[model samples]
Target chain A: MNTVSTSPYLAGLLQGQPPASPLTWLNELRANAVDRVGALTVPTTRDEDWRFTDISPLTKLSFQPAQGAAQLAPAAIEQWAIPEAAARLVFVDGIYAPGHSFNRAGLTVENLASGVSRHGAAVQAHLGRYADFERNVFTAVNTAFLHDGALILVPRDTALAAPVHLLFIATRKHAASYPRCLIVAESGSAVTVVEDYVALQSEAYFTSAVTELALTGNAEVHHVRVQREGAEAFHFANCAVSLAQASRYHSVSIALGGRISRHNLAALLAAEGAECRLDGLALIGGQQLADSHTLIDHASPRGSSRQLHKCIVDGAARAVFNGNIMVRPGAQRTDSSQSSRNLLLSARARVDTKPQLEIFADDVKCAHGATVGQLDVDEVFYLKSRGLSDTAARNLLTYAFGAEVIERIPVASLRNRLEQTVMERTHAAAPGAEGKP
Target chain B: MIYQDSKTLLSVRDLHASVSGTRILKGMNLTVKSGEVHAIMGPNGSGKSTFAKVLAGHPSYEVSGGEIEFEGRNLLELAAEARARAGVFLGFQYPIEIPGVANSQFLRLAYNTVQAGRGEDELDPLEFDDFVREKMKLLEMNPDFLDRSVNEGFSGGEKKRNEILQMALLEPRLAILDETDSGLDIDALRIVAGGVNQLANKDNAIVLVTHYQRLLNYIVPDYVHVMDAGRIVKTGGKELALELEERGYDWVGAEAKANARVNA
Candidate 1:
């Protein structure tokens, strides 16, 4: 390795890391991640992957790793309770809060620190394996700091009737938290997992999260990730998934908060007849920035993937979507399509959407499109002609645009909560520019 | 249905309008009394649609110089939604499709908004469902339409029928139908025309802007006006539709040009 010193930013973030794990393999994994973090530096706008997103604001601040979990009352988190969730794993400031969590599904759903000791072989086989921390500094940092997180392993031929919710809440200012999750679905098993990131404080904080999912043959997994951090926080996340033969993976991620947030998702279709569907939405306003980058790799024959991402931006906020689909050389009959649509609710609001498709297989079918525009005037007029005011019409249309993705969520209480949040945000963002004659 | 003391519902005086700096309605004038059905017929690009849009206060069209009075109020000063609340409706030739909004929700909101503007109590969803279902039967519409998105994936004729359904719900005093029968089959046309005929009464007036005399045959107009070059050039009774149907619009344009030359 090159003898380059760690940058002051990385050195500052490396402070207050948890002590080494008792498990040797886990300790070795953490040691390798620490070395990778030392080798890599924080990316800038000049980096091709971060050309549109400028994260210098994130580097200017110093953050210490959270030491202990904050004392939160049960009532503080009662509003986020999902009546349909079979289990909930609550993490406060990246530390597991066992007092506020429950699991009734009789599955292996527990904190990673304790889980690694019990499921050591299984955890070592998958943990830090799919998500490549060598090249990515944030993932490396998350891997280096990963000690306690949400761990779920579904047994073979088992199907859970209810979902598992992983709730990560930020409660401190100028503190950095690494939230990690690993889910493995065995052959012929199915599960629904929800990864939720929220905040109890409005002050500036940093959240770096990494999630890995592995689906074996004939396994199915539905993943829903929602990031609603504080207005002054910084959030970055990376999710890597691998699909085996005839396995299916479906994911819907919504970004509605954070001063500066970025989420990177990569799905690898490893074996034949694997399928993946990805849907995302970022509803932001008021100088906030949300960036989403997704990659769907069809590496085997008969693999299919479909993705749709939408953004509704208001005020001076900005949203970015970069989606890439790759059909490998031997991946015949690979079918994939992606659409990126954005709505700018104000003149100052901005959107950057890019859809890329690469197909080496001649018989593969791939289509992609990107659109950034204001609301359709004809649609607004149609609603207005029916006696709705201009403001109401624009708000309704904006809500409808985001609702297309929200409707895909399977959980009823979560879906209703998100619908209410979308409606409130759209209405609150609809006054100044939308009400103009 | 014309009464002895039928009041004037709409009066357009020298309505000059343009869209994107191109003059569309140049000094167009018309007056409609309550209970009268007027047909504004013209060839393509003859300002028939523009006239209907202008009356509805479409934002794209600029009224550089004009005045429109609806029920003795200055309709030009009101916004599109305000005009709708003020009992003015425009049936678009190509109704817009809103993909995510349910049809029942849209219709109920429209109905409640108009009802609230009239100082009447609004009905809840259950009450409105009963009220709207009864109205849908008049147009022979399927109840399943309530569950689908508004006008999304609807056939051309189905969109027109939806427009009439809204008209029936809102009960506007002055209704302008701009090519409402453009894309309908014979059976759809008969059903749609029957719905419009049923909604028309002595308290309201209907204005049909069409290019063909086919729609006029069903919902017969009391007066037929031929428009050309952005202004009406010929005005006659219902028989004029039949005459124009047989002897095409070329003679009318020629006659208008000759008349303009003689007057000049």
Candidate 2:
């Protein structure tokens, strides 16, 4: 535990390490990121976003950077692989697994380590460009550590026919992994990226991830970050997406595992005529906790944004959803709406959801609502009267509660996988169980 | 006491029930036999719906004093699902719409439950699918209807048709059609009644509870019982429904109260 003095040990690991790249341009950004990380601190209950989700587990966990020349066996890779992905990028213990990545042309996919070691120029231009590190301590810490992650660049006017799947697996217990991702969809380009943060081992673990995306002018990007870590693990992530003129951005955040988890997601509709849609679902059980904090900024005129988040909590589990949508002045016709619905499956289960909307533009249409309730009794009785047992009744109602959001995922096989995982957790009243399809 | 015979399918003796401490069904008595259909008709606020709801074991309704025996087994001792498993089906006047449970899924569950209760192995998904498809075709229902949520967006006639479809699947020993024809067009009435007529077998009984006599023209009942002020006051053959439709409920109510006073 003493080895884990700070949130992440990457900064200390690279303190005296020699630069493998010919250029030293990124050194300045690295120093700046470290300074930013040094300045910010983990939040407490006093902070608005950290009000419901407890951060003690994160502060107490022991973390160490992955050592050099550690090989993840092929059998382990095959057992936990995402076969449905068009392209797969594997990161084990926060280090890029060399033989595990499958890259193709018209789409540039590579490990952040290779780009930083060999191609410093391209790495310096985009790293830590889209996130606001100062506002979130976890995001700043990830940037400072930033050892390795997946970097995907979609060339201008090029649209990938399939989804690029990024997988980060936690293979060591009582250890921390920092997986950073940056996706750039160039002008007139279209691409979809699915980032999965999964725990390969059942032992206790902590994973802090940062994913940044930028959609260039007239570009369309769909990004989904699904975290289904093992129980006895602490998961934290920060996702930021920015849209340019006439570009479209859609994101779905699903938090279904981890003993303690929190997600910080922010989207900026900065270009005129751009559209942004954000949806999320969180299924929590056991002593597990999942909290999501989202902010949407409608900065330009005629841009629209919509957000919907649903949460289901059972057992002694707790869930939190805090969403804010801001329509700035002169951002007229910025249609934005946000809503959060929660279902408490047990008397001990709890949910705290808040939807905040700030509309400086009088002409903008912005509305928000939040609801926390148990399963509808009449609905339960109706199903039970039809011969379904009580468990079946509650399970059906809870599945429906989250199905509306899961259905919007647009990935059939992926949605089915998440639905199965959620159903299994629904029965055990705990995270990290297997579900029957 | 009514239907003092072992051949009776459903027997009620001075049945009394209440909701929220307020008694609704006071001394209601009725009986039915296999192969015969009975229609209980009454005016509004006459506790006509209470008898149907009580038999279905609605939690809100308390059975204060009653002996409801279905196939010689005590009905009040069972829960709603138990009563359903015991082969007593209630076609709700206004069926509740369950948003997430799919129509075919709910029907399969109901069918498997009844089958299991009768000591039969539950049909697997493929077998259940085949079974449901055949039943849907028999009722002239579209195959796509099974994919939708249970009556989530069903029309009035569609809801009634769905009820009859369930009846055909479960093959209950006693079917309680609670105002099944209240919200239907003449065409919908014929289709729904046709489905119900096809499902009623000689081994099962049908209790059609309605206010109007029009539905009787399609699925004619063996007997019509006139209920007023929480008790059945008149019992006659099928023609009784037509006579009451013409004479109105006012005369029946006046005659029932007068007869009670004379007996007192």
Candidate 3:
């Protein structure tokens, strides 16, 4: 168990002490990752993925090591908790809130800090294995100060009846929330995890988070990320997943808020006959900006990956979508597809899309496509003629655009919650609530 | 009021329109007053549908030389949505399928847009649901149809009924039923025609554009105009539709070619 403290350095030292000689390599890796975070500059308008989205808001924040010491008002975390989750982990200002958590059998949900302090071997072995810190600065930073995340471990052949919910709340006082998560499903295990990051208040803050997931052979895993930060909040999150032979992985990311936000996800099909699906939907309004970049690597033969990402941009908001699929050599019969679509609701709204495919294997079926467009007038007319007002019609069309991704989500309740979030965000972006449900 | 019973709902004089540099409606002329139902009967490619689309301000159709007035206001000046707001509705021959737009939500937006254009407050979802439920009843449409996406996965009959449901809700001053019967089965035609009849008040006019006189049997028009070679060659009463159906379109075409030769 971790001793709660306000000093970030003391908290870091108490949390970072390695257990024994056997775990020295991982501790060293964590130190190196921290150095990388310090060396590498946070992305700005200069980077391709960060072009349309400005990180100036993030750079202005004086990020502190949030040591899970801040107290949240009664019933605050409950308002954002997933009601049907079998197990729930709540984090307030990047620190675990033990009193707000729900317990479950055959499942262990602990803060990364405590996991490192207690279950050091298990925590250190798989903490940063899946995530590639070299490719992303935020991931490196998360690894360096990876003390505030939730670790979920599902033992072999355990099929959880309900999803595990992880809630991270970024409050105005905390100013910054750095969240790191690790979910490992052993062979033949089945589990669903919903990771939600929300702003507790409408104030300027930053959330830098990382989630690393692994699926052993034949394990089925479902993961969903719902980011509903405040209008003045800056959010950066990355998820890296590794799939073993015959394992199935389904992941969906919904980014609908924040002033400046970025989501980077990478899925590696490491063994033969693995299945990976990455789906995302984003709704942006006001002067908000959101950037999403994804990569699906077919590292072995007989692997399949499908990626679909959709964005709705309204007001003067901006969005950027980058999807890439890599088919390495000898990865035969690798069926992979990637598509990114953007619908601009306002004339001032803008979207930049890039879909690329690199296929080194000749026997692979790989395709990538990207499209950016305004709502089709004819399509709008079709709806308006049915007696919907212009604003209502546009909102319906926008919801429908994002629904394609929401429908693919395995959990119905989470999907419904996300639908409401998307509708609310869209209404805020649009002129009126004429068509909102 | 969105309509005046004694005034002309639609008036076109020497109207010309083209798409992609190809002329479609060449000097077409027509007029319809509120409370009147007029059917424009013509063969394919005779510009019957173009007249309807141009009146609705389809983006691709260029109104090169035309004067269109609806209830004394210049129709050609309004954009498609403005025209819609100004009480002009066009039932597309091929209704586009908008994948994500719900059938119910689309109807509400259209109704509210028209209301807002007429200087009225917009209806919220709760109010619009009641409004649409009442209209759907007249069309004999199931309540579930409102939850589906616009025109997506709809059968031919369902699409036609959906169009009529829209016409009933918006209550346009002049409803251009462009090939509304093109892809309907007998059951769909009856339901669609029934819906039109329920909404057809004495204050609004209807313009039915079709190639066949089949739909005329369900909803008889007050007048019928025979168009050929981009121009109307003849106009008569409802009996004209029966006559054209019995005699075929050769007589109208022959007369049109004769007029073209004389003009040339």
Candidate 4:
């Protein structure tokens, strides 16, 4: 880790007075966050949590908050939108672009800044409650710039007919944007939210994003985030979720972009019988590096969770996956399983996956495993024997390895879109890098 | 060597091959014309499987010095996929498991590739699904196999049937079966052989590479060739297979040694 990127404070991001807000409480919340950002620094290699990922590039630059939504041609973002989404929100450069967004009935989807403008007490109770900024600096940065993002709330007993797609587009060079999202699913409600991050060009930018999801009793949420930023961009994202009694949460994070990207995913099971499934897939190649750090905390009795995180490394790229499942005291009857499957496509591509289970509850069923491998030679031979070229065979096999985890997503349209993305990318999941056609 | 004709589908002359610096096929020779069924029988380590893989241009074995002609073209110069596109098929003894690619997708890609190579119209997914289902009935393979991954969880017999299914779909001019009947039960053998029999015509040829004569009883061969120490020592009619089965292979090995010494 370089010393410059590891520094704790980055100046000149505040610009001016916090924001023009009617609510003093929200303004005070933002004020406290700026103070927190000044105190908490970027996690360094000495920090056990960030041992494998180096954020030196992030420390060297000072970024200004993106100005406003820029007008892009219609055809650019149309490819990323699925018609199946009931409500679609488009944010260009971390600011909502109304011209490119759509919303359906029976659901409330508004910009975070708009939600704060109305000054409703309901938004006040849920916002910033699930994410903690005492230890994480990125969360504080997002909180300091919390006037914009996607604000969603699902009412009780309403099962959404279609998902809400939040599309975040990063553009411009040497600019920084803090994208925040708050999803509060009321009791007995079911919803799915997709966070899609894309880039139109290979210009360098910084996207410090945070999302807080709170699921009440008997609520269900399926959260999927796709990160496909440009190869030169930087992405730092954190998702903190809390589940109530009998609530279920499932999340799949696909990271496939940026020069240096790290996703911090943590879930808390706070009530009995709450179930969760945490899955992730990262595709890194060239000189890029992506890291996924996950923590699942079981605080109540009879809670269960299952996790499978996988990464495919190609070229000289590197990937890191750290998954920890904790069964706290008095959390009996906890059933959790975690596995990390890493595939190395070249001699230089590498992965560091650590699956840990810290159990304080004596009577619990917990299992964790980790594996790193390459494509099977016999399988490749078989594909080649059937008239497939060497490159096609290797690509097909590499796509399948990622598909094993991606196919777990139940939504057909979402699953198919992701399948297309993985297939279209480079098939560097084979051993040798030289002489590949 | 068998006499070559205008109807010849494959012609092999003085073929030599080795793997990892060790010679496996040394000056082996054979010739097969369309409409003919030839069976090559040999004991362990005689390179019957190696010859089949070499025909399909497997990357493992290098043709040190030899010649292989298929369909009036030099076979060794083509890549494995190019050979498949040019109508050469090899049935592996051990089918590999591909865990996530659907069987139907695999079959269609191969079928369309060969069709494209021949300048024929390619079938779309829906059309290929119907065509593949019809072919599946010949092997009694369940329709569910189309949705599952290729040979991932299939039984040993099912894997062989899949190989034959590919052979049937591609409609290769020369089909080589390497121990396809090694692990099949009696019933499976009849079904698979029956499928093979239906596929044989005057436009293509079939080569059965096997260890036991039991398979020959189902799909009788026109010529039976005895391979020993990487060379064909004897070539006779189909009845020669039964004779070898009865008399065993030691006498044949000894006779070849005696003949070699006499020639020297």
Candidate 5:
């Protein structure tokens, strides 16, 4: 394999790394990731995996690693606080902010820096194992700088009544932040986790995040990820999930910000009778671009998976969705269905959607469908005939298109906040507001 | 009932319209006065539904040549929503299914929009809920429908009732019902027609565009006009609907053609 040439852009991003961790395995993991980053180059349109999403804008600008955590007041982040969260961990610029965080769940929910010292074996066994960075430059870069992250471990047969919130806030421009998260749900345990990313300013920045989730036998994990970066930010995230026997994983990811953002999620049903449900929504406007790639691997018998992804693009924006479902040769009775629905609100808006299925097992059932369209003319006229203006009708339909996916989010307060945000974004991108009749 | 002294609500003169460059309405002319119900009967492609859509200013239909005056103003200048706000309502033949938008929310918006247009007080959600629940009783709609998406997964009868429910909420000065009886059972037809009858008054007019006389039996019309090809070809009283229903529409088309040849 050719592992010699690394682009100057990748070299520039590898500038300021934190000192080596005291843990030997952790340091070794970082060293391997740095070598991998040196081997992989930035992906371009020529790459089959990134044929539609061009990240040249991210490589055009140079970003430095964040120096220190920003001192933030608890009141500043009060708006994003979840009342139903049993524990909360706040990270500013990829560094844990102890002043704005609290842990009351009596579980192992803390910063990875300290959690590693306490639970080194569990962290070492699962950290760099699931999210493989052999060919993924973004994931390699994230792993190379994975010093601070959120770590949660649910004990066996324990069920938490409330969710755990992991909030990452970006407060500086021209700064590169690698946000990492690793959650381990033991056998028969149940937990909900929210990995949220938000920005305080509208300036160019870079965020490469990697998250790994491991569900043990009969364990249930509800993952809700929200990426609300600034309008001029670049965000790339990789999430890997492994489901054991009879485990259930439900994930809902919403992308509403970032000038260019891409999220890659891979879920492996490694044991029999495992189930997963993946729901996603991207509501973008004003020249923004969002891409989502997901892979569901049915490695064992009786594994079932369902996925529904939607995108509402307006004002010259573009959205892309690629979903892949694979049923292995010996995986009998592996049922899977996936749908990618996109709505273009303006004439210049565009969407690239593909829902693919690869089934090798004769007894497996798999179905996939993709649709890219604009607001239905009949639906718009139906609303207008009820005395709603053209703008109101268009905005309402756009909001409804996204609400279907947002409703799947398990948290009530978060769901309400996202619903409100979707409504406001649709109105702001309306033709009437833009002075177009 | 036709009152001679009633004010004229709508006057159309040589209204010509088309869809996708194919003319559907060919020089249609009609005049509607308040406190009167006019039934425009015709075959499937006779432009009855096209007339209703044109009146509502549907974007698909292009008005190539026409003059539409409503309340002594140029009606064609206003948009669909503007026309709706100005007291013109079109009950669609196929009630649209708007998923994710609750029925209560849609009804409240339409009601408040027309209310605002008339410089009247608008009701808040709580007040609107109470007011709309009373109106729903007129159509015998279940209260659970208010929470469901607008017309989504609704039965044929339920969709028809929802359309009439909107008619009750808006209380428009002119309502053109286009084939509203096509997908309804006898019980639903009676309920929908009863709701329409309650909404009628001396200040408003109703136009029923239908293919059958079954709807005319419930909400009787003062004038029944037979339309063929595009324009109205024959005019008579309410009995004309029964006559055409019994004799079929071929005779009327032949008689109109014979008359056209004589005039030529």
Candidate 6:
């Protein structure tokens, strides 16, 4: 119905798009998403929110939807799985893989493709409600191509003993993927979910992921996402959360890969005395560009939030952080704070950080700050003076910088794994590292 | 160089060094033989600290012309860490605080590193804990300090005591304590001096870089040398320290200027 021509990538995507499921309501959502995306123009640098990131290359590339799940060997797949996790949902190139996943009792994890046939009513009640697809282009794209994802449903008054992990692996070459998930936690329930994005092959690809969560009264949730994709990949992910009265939400996002990766995370405190904690760590090097934008909205009275985002840039890599806290009117006694700390390891490396607090409420307490600096020279020299090698000194300090955020995780085994991963990615110095060490 | 024992531990001959194109040490000469404790005293801006840093292979000091031999090896050829492993310790006047790194871990790494250099067996964490606790008793340090970050939020006196604790652990053969007594109270000064006195023996040498004569009162020096204008102008026994404290450095500077003019 439109006169304007679509980008080549969009044209290719539409041609290979899979047919919607037989459920009429699900089909209606997809049909509405297609028209919504067609009418709204793509975001550009001129937009205030998208000023720092350039998506022209993403629009120019001619990519089609992945044909099928990648058939990676079982041993390679097991090597990446967390053995201690209570349950797991494994997806390969936007399709659920049964052989690679393990589901335990006490929680309902339904695959979206098959979920529509069984729990279609519960799924339809929560899927498209939390994620604002109308204003977000990537969310609109994901909704239009919502073929398969995990549907997590936690019952009332139930507490998951251990974390449920979602392992989303990419193996499609030069293809675009849309991965979606919706989690609904009932009253007085508690759960923790971890999503890990990794690629089996080192080929160019596009991955746009969206996750929605709705926590009812007195529910608690912990969400952790780790992105370790390949060097030639482009990754964009958004997590939208809604917290009810007296509920708690805590989330941490760690970005260590992808040539160009962008993460947008936002939480809405909709009821009285709801609390949330948002923290993240980003480690990018070697011509990589990683950007993270976060928002914490306090809509009700006496809501509290804390946010901390840290970045370490090296080897001509660039990092950007934009954190906004909005304390709306009538949200009295709202306590919100945000801090962004960045360490640049090379002169060629760059970082731009902005922490904003927009308080319309009269009796709210809020604070925010951003700091960009290199490692301390005198500290490095002091380490070297104690018989540590130059590289060892730098590695120690760099690890300590990122460990501040990793230490906030409560799981010991998961923390140990992240520590090792951070060590491997942070061992090398950026060019000279330039200090006396 | 004159000494009762024949073996020399450190020999600096006509050392000239600069930092950032500004000359700091000009043709400095000193010699310390084994079984000796030497104290280098000077007024401010006499390059006493610079000489200590240069001897420890600090990267800031560019050696325009110098030759330093420690334990019969050319100290200039070794890197800073190599010099540390080679048993040359420089106790900093101002210790830097490294946040987020535990003090116990830093001490373990440092101890194991130097031990490995000497082909000695390295201690694991459990073994090193017992060893470090025994060493801490020598300085009267609490065991709870092991849990805190390295020098973070520590008082000035506590930092000085930590420097002494490192000296006890490393057991360096030639230690140049640069102004180790600058920021210490009387009680802290006593403990630090007592630890240094116990560590000194006939097999090694100690060089104390200080401004006041109070430190020499506790740890008596075999030789006290006066440095003026980046060069040693007077050398005598421990009695010189008392004389310098009593009559002040102006007399020495005047005498040195007169001698220099006569020689020229």
Residue pairs with clashing backbones, model 1: none
Q: Which CAPRI level is candidate 6? A: acceptable
Model 1 TM-score (B-chain only): 0.99
Candidate topping DockQ: 1
| Window of ten residues with lowest summed lDDT in model 4 chain B | B1-10
Output per-candidate TM-scores for chain A, rounded to 2 decimals: 0.97, 0.90, 0.90, 0.93, 0.96, 0.94
By summed lDDT, the worst window of 10 consecutive residues in model 4 chain A runs over A1-10
Clash number by candidate, in order: 0, 0, 15, 2, 0, 0
Lowest lDDT block of 10, candidate 3 chain B: B1-10
Could you give candidate 1's per-residue lDDT for residues A16-38 as a string of tens digits? 77887788888788778888988
What C-alpha lDDT, on a 0 to 100 scale, does residue A232 get in candidate 3?
83
Return whichever of 4 and 5 wins on lDDT.
5
TM-score for the B chain of model 4: 0.97
DockQ score of each predicted structure, in the order shown: 0.45, 0.39, 0.33, 0.33, 0.42, 0.29
* Cα lDDT tens digits for candidate 5, A1-437: 12233788888888888788889888888888888988888999999999999999998899988888888877889989999999999989888999888999889999998999899999988898899899899999888888888999999999997999999999999999998899999999999999999989899999999999999999999999999999999999999999999999999999999999999999999999999999999999888999999999999999999999999888889999999898998999998989898998789998999888888899988888888888888888887887888888888888778878887888999998998998888888764532111
Q: Is candidate 2 or candidate 3 better by TM-score?
A: 2
What are the RMSD figures for all models against the true structure? Answer: 2.7, 4.2, 5.4, 5.0, 3.1, 4.8
Which lDDT values do the candidates have, in the order given? 0.91, 0.79, 0.80, 0.85, 0.91, 0.85
The Cα error of candidate 3 at residue B147, in Å, is 2.3
TM-score of chain B of each: 0.99, 0.96, 0.94, 0.97, 0.99, 0.97
For candidate 5, give the DockQ.
0.42
Model 6 Cα displacement at B138 (Å)?
4.8
Candidate 1 residue-wise lDDT, B1-264, digit = tens: 567899999989998999999998888999999999999998899999999988887899999887899898999989999999999998999998876667898899888888888888888999999999999999999999998888989999999999999999999999999999999999999999999999999999999999999998899999999999899999999999999999989999999999999999
Clashing pairs in 2: none
How high is each candidate's TM-score? 0.94, 0.88, 0.82, 0.83, 0.92, 0.82
Q: Order of candidates by lDDT, top first? A: 1, 5, 4, 6, 3, 2
User: After aligning candidate 5 to the native by TM-score, how far in Å is the CA of A312 from where it should be?
Assistant: 2.8
Supply the TM-score for candidate 2.
0.88
Model 6, position A188: C-alpha lDDT score:
96
